[model samples]
Target: MKPLLVVFVFLFLWDPVLAEMHKKCYKNGICRLECYESEMLVAYCMFQLECCVKGNPAP
Candidate 1:
């Protein structure tokens, strides 16, 4: 029971870390898309590519 509780607590704490990592990647992709003005299409394409690579379907 003690080991199970420890595992549960570890997993609970770990989830937010994983979520933040994904959020950072997604935000970086958005920032990249926003940074350039003339090559908007290219920037958007790159962002989409990054999202695909990261397995984030709704970014």
Candidate 2:
């Protein structure tokens, strides 16, 4: 019973993490905004990309 509970918890957290991994990290609007917003959008985009990559490492 305990093992099953642990597995269920693991699975619950796992799906969202995997889903986040496949999400696209950038949009064109952010690119344009970054040009004028002191690069804030660029940093945000890069952070999101890193999150995606960390969740799903490249080959």
Candidate 3:
């Protein structure tokens, strides 16, 4: 029972969003976990992620 309670507490405290919080990009943009369709990648955000910025999206 104690182990189960510990596991639950750990799970509750662990958050993916908190781990991948928004980081500042180099240019006028934001480092994101995932880039939007209208946003263009400008630089590296972190491992597997890149910096993103609002640009004239391709047609």
Candidate 4:
């Protein structure tokens, strides 16, 4: 029972985390150009741009 509960919890959170990767790409234009291997880079770049700049997107 405990194991099943743990699995369920993980599954619920896993989908969101995975889905966010694609969502992040849409939020940033560069995502269309990025490959699977470049996902982390795109996401990091987006996060930094969001934090570093005000309203302006990263180039």
lDDT of 4 by residue, 1-59 (tens): 99999999999887755554445333443422234432334234332331121143346
Poorly placed runs, candidate 2 (over 4 Å): 27-59
Instruction: List the lowest-lDDT window of 10 residues for candidate 4.
Output: 45-54
> Per-residue lDDT of 31-56 in model 2, one digit per residue for the tens?
22123322323224332433111222
Model 4, position 36: C-alpha lDDT score: 40
lDDT values for all models? 0.41, 0.43, 0.72, 0.44
Clashing residue pairs, backbone N/CA/C < 3 A, model 1? none
Query: What lDDT is reached at residue 39 by model 2?
Result: 30
- TM-score, candidate 2, is 0.45
Instruction: Put down candidate 1 lDDT per residue, 1-59, tens digits, no spaces.
Output: 99999999999987765554344343344322233333222223322322212222333
Model 1: ten consecutive residues of lowest lDDT: 46-55
lDDT of 3 at 29: 80
Candidates sorted by lDDT, best first: 3, 4, 2, 1
Which is superior by TM-score, 2 or 3? 3
TM-score of each: 0.38, 0.45, 0.53, 0.42
Highest lDDT: give the candidate number: 3
Cα displacement (Å) at residue 28, model 4: 3.3
After superposition, the stretches of candidate 4 with alpha carbons farther than 4 Å from their true spots are 25-59
Clashing pairs in 2: none
